[model samples]
Target: MKTEIRFTHQSLVENSKSGDRTAQYQLYELYVDAMYNVSMRFLGVKEDAEDIVQESFVDAFRNLDKFKYESSFGAWLKRIVINKSINHLKVKRLPLAAMDDNEYHLTNEDEHEYQNIDAMDIMKVKSGIEKLPYGYKQIINLYLLEGFDHNEISDVLGITTSTSKSQYHRAKKKLVEIINTL
Candidate 1:
């Protein structure tokens, strides 16, 4: 079933690449909301998210020919959107700090301590996330909300893997503190 859906999506993408306006629109309709959500996760501002989504789609269409089938079209498009979002943040001078290797290390024991956060109120957690500093917020959103692992986060943000892991651990701690205060 999943393979069939992917083939259908790929066909639409191929048609769009061939300049079929209806196929392009279909692809847009299929992915706009998800892409919009991805933009919103990186950018809290509605206007910024909307602008990035538009820009991402335009860029995606323009470069459709360069897209190879190594990954799903959605995955390919997501990479484009994420890169655009990060670039937008860079333009705004959002500073993501690099951490020393020895600054923070998470043991399995420490991981167990934070598992209780899963039971916290969703609204409260989201509010806490929004209240975080820009750098911390981005790391948290990429790792926790967007399902990117530390290596992937490092690549996306142009930080080292160690920095990504350190930032994520610190961000999780800070988020807990924020949620506790609320």
Candidate 2:
């Protein structure tokens, strides 16, 4: 038998489910910034991220009855924000996967410049990710930062699992190169 996992804020969820406006507002306040950050990571624009996060919260609240506590409310809300962000990108004709074999071409003038740098810190990594192209950045953000596996990424991006795996590997290689040059 399976059981629903209890959430830390179970009362808030339950109250919100029962049409309690105050509980809903509290839940929104708790998650808004985090969800906005998640959308920003994908969409990379302040206004778009804000809109996506707001829409995600509205959808989550309206469909509160479908949330069975199998996952934390934060986790469920995060998925909503991510999905909305990706859809926003798709509607705007943004790239989710690198085209062809673009990640394979290196622009270094000499082989001596390939020295590996190991002084990676959070700020450096964050800046490096920001410098990545849209496709590579999405893969890195999803697979590395967001902790999504290839299968989940494939499902989210509507691609095959092999494509997701390959894209993630290529994106990681590009990210490492960028970090080294930073």
Could you say which candidate leads in TM-score?
1
Could you tell me every candidate's TM-score relative to the true structure?
A: 0.90, 0.84
Compared with the true structure, the alpha-carbon lDDT of candidate 2 equals: 0.82
Weakest ten-residue segment in model 1 by summed lDDT:
1-10
lDDT of 1 by residue, 1-182 (tens): 44333338889989989998878888898999999998888888899998998898889999999988999889989888888998999999987765687899999998997999999999999999998888898899888887899999989988889889899888899999999999
> Which stretch of 10 consecutive residues in model 2 shows the poorest summed lDDT?
109-118
What would the TM-score be for candidate 1 when compared with the true structure? Answer: 0.90
User: Where is model 2 more than 4 Å wrong at Cα?
Assistant: 1-8, 98-119
Query: Clashing residue pairs in candidate 2, if any?
Result: none
lDDT of 2 by residue, 1-182 (tens): 97633344899999999998878888988899899889999988999999999899999999999999999999999999988988898899987654553434444443234344344687888988898888778888889789999899989988777777667766767777888787
Residue 167's lDDT within candidate 1 is 91
Error of 1 at 73 (Å): 1.3
